[model samples]
Target: MTYKLGLTGSIGMGKSTTARMFRDMGFPVWDADEAVHRLYASGGAAVAPIAAMFPTALDNGGIDRKALKLALANDPEAIERLEAVVHPLVAKDRENFLQKHSDSPLAVLDIPLLFEKGSEWQFDGVAVVSTDADTQRNRVLSRPGMTEKHFEMIHARQMPDAEKRARADWIIPTDTLESARAAVERICNEIVTDA
Candidate 1:
């Protein structure tokens, strides 16, 4: 049977980088963030439902992410409405990805909000990538248009990294690139030997 691993981390914690490393190690991966981008980009099936909910935030059958962000800022239900339209589509895509790699010994689902969304039920095990809070804050602030308030707001929506670590099967720390890579490689080693 294929082993499904759920990988997650708070924003700017090198989750994407770790996911890439897993791919380099020859594991198939399903990235939820990329799935969301696809749903917002050209030819996305999510554009219609989204446009219907917030007509002004779409153009030519695609979502204007900046506009959507502004629209959802103060509106409590806008995010809920948006997630309602997007999650099902992403879930379907994820299911397809899993089926395609069912023969593999292991596959990874790189979901930033796996625990927040209670998505771990579908996985065989979970891993969390982590960094010190200051490092996380600095990394996030370095991004264009990311303000401290915005970072705080995003953090508010996520489970605390400490709490997440408590729940992780393995915690991979990304203080240095080489060390992070080694930490993840070590986890892969554990996975192979655990059985």
Candidate 2:
């Protein structure tokens, strides 16, 4: 049987980078964010339903993320409504990914909201990438158009880093690239050994 591992972290915690490291080490990785991006693109499964739900959020050919964000901000129930339209499509995409990688000894599903969505039970194990608050804040602030309010808003929606770490089967501290890479290697080695 294949080992399915779920990888997650709060914003600016190097989750994507660590996922790439897993890919580099030969694990097939399915990225939830990428799946959503594809789903929201023109001719994608999510486009028509999302357009029906929020017509103003559709651009020339695809879903306008900024407009969607504005809609969510304006309506207290908008996120739940939006998820109702999009979550099933994302779930289907993940299912397809799992089917494609079924033969692999181990595979990773990179879901930013795995814990928040209560989908961690689907994985054999879960890994969280973490860093100090200062580093995380600084990294997020360095991104274009990132502000304190935006950071706080994102943070409010996610589980705290401490809580995430506590729940993680493997905790990777990504204070530096070298350390993060070492941790990834170690985790891969351990998983291989266990399997």
Candidate 3:
């Protein structure tokens, strides 16, 4: 059986970079964001249901994320409704990935909201990537089209970094690439050895 490790972090915490480190180490990584993107792309599983719920979110036979964001912003409950349609699909995608890598000793599931969604239970262990608040804010704000307000909104949705670290089986400090990579290697060694 594969050991499933749920990797998570708030925006700008270097979760994507950490996921890449795992990939570099030859571990199969299933990215939840990428899975959602696949689901939102044209001819994907979520287009019809999402379009049915918010026609304005439909663009060229696919779900337009920007338009969906606007719709969700206008309606306080829209996020929940959207999740209701998408979560099952995402879960199915993850399940398929896990099954595909069943023989592997370790598989990483890169889930941005793993803790917030109460999905930590689904994995054998959880790793939370984190950085100081200032670094996180700076990294996020430096991104194109990222405003302070947008950063705050995204940050608010995630569980606090401290809380996540407290709950994590391993905490990967992403203050620098070297540190993060070292943590990843350590975690990988431990898990693979035990597996």
C-alpha displacement of 29 in model 3, angstroms?
A: 0.6
Q: Candidate 1, residue 113: CA error in Å?
A: 1.2
lDDT of 1 by residue, 64-183 (tens): 988888889869888988888899999998888999998887889999889998878888999999999999999999999999999999999999999999999988899988988998
Off by over 4 Å in 1: none
Candidate 2: residue 85 lDDT (0-100): 78
Q: Which is the better candidate, 1 or 2, if ranked by TM-score?
A: 2
What number of backbone clashes does candidate 2 have, counting pairs of residues 3 or more apart or in separate chains? Answer: 0
Candidate 3 on 57-138: residue-level lDDT in tens?
9999899999998999899998899999999999999999989998889999999989998889999999999999999999
**Segments of candidate 2 deviating more than 4 angstroms:** none
Better of 1 and 3 by TM-score: 3
Q: Is candidate 2 or candidate 3 better by lDDT?
A: 3
RMSD of each: 1.6, 1.2, 1.1
Give the number of the best model, judged by TM-score.
3
Per-prediction TM-score to the true structure, in the order listed: 0.92, 0.95, 0.96
